[model samples]
Target: MFVFTPTPGTTWNLTVDNFTQALHRREGDEAYIHTHADAEGSYGPRDEHDWWFAFSATGESWAGTGSPAAGDHEGVALDEATAGAAAEFAAWVLRELVPPGAGMEYNTRVGMESGLPDEVLTENTVTELDAVFRKHLKASSS
Candidate 1:
């Protein structure tokens, strides 16, 4: 899984509420976002693309991705299905959250552990993530 966060001192004060409010899904679309049962954020098993998106309150930003609801299945793997789902999730995130021309330096990491300030890899706008989303989701009109 991968993660992102607004750099400290940035004016963007992310809250779990924004994620709940930015709920957008095409009509008849099975994709959705639901507040986690216990956590201070949201989670959903999007069956449409076998992907899921999450909001971590601690990080005040994007959480990593994995199919927690892939009930009774093998664990997270880097196969095509896993990769596709992750790509789709990332696309949805950038499309729904990352405002156009957002200049805040967003911290990022590539581990499953999110919301930690000590593991910051690069504290900058990770435009590469946006590009990757565009590449994978270009053919998807939804």
Candidate 2:
């Protein structure tokens, strides 16, 4: 799974399996689902192409061309404000990625973790999730 904070108030969570299945169903291509882990203790698995992108708190961004292992999965540590923004992004992603004919099976655990700062986990969290997903899709494509 890939996790990140697209903006100050948003957390993005994504799984390779879910993404691959959704893309296959929508684009009818299976290449997007093809990825493998290179390192044993990595947070997320590395793709054969070794492409990985991550956003850090120090305003640092990382992307490279090397295989990553499943243990390489990383989480987006967010504050209350940022978490809220992430929820909105997640909602946008759901709207765009979830196809009309696609069933709930394609749904993924793409959301913030519970026990977050109450201020961030407000009623709008769902919206943030959608927005986060939208941002992720855009970034992944580009």
**Which 10 residues in a row give candidate 1 its minimum summed lDDT?**
72-81
Q: Please tell me which predicted candidate would have the highest TM-score against the true structure.
A: 1
With a 3 Å backbone cut-off (N, CA, C), the pairs that clash in candidate 1 are: none
- Candidate 1, position 29, lDDT: 41
Query: Tens digits of per-residue lDDT for model 1 on 114-139?
Result: 33332222222235544543443332
lDDT of 1 at 42: 47
| Candidate 2 Cα lDDT to native | 0.34
Model 1 clash tally, residue pairs: 0
RMSD of every candidate to native, in Å, equals 12.9, 12.3
Task: Estimate every model's Cα lDDT from 0 to 1.
Answer: 0.34, 0.34
Candidate 1 yields a Cα-based lDDT of 0.34
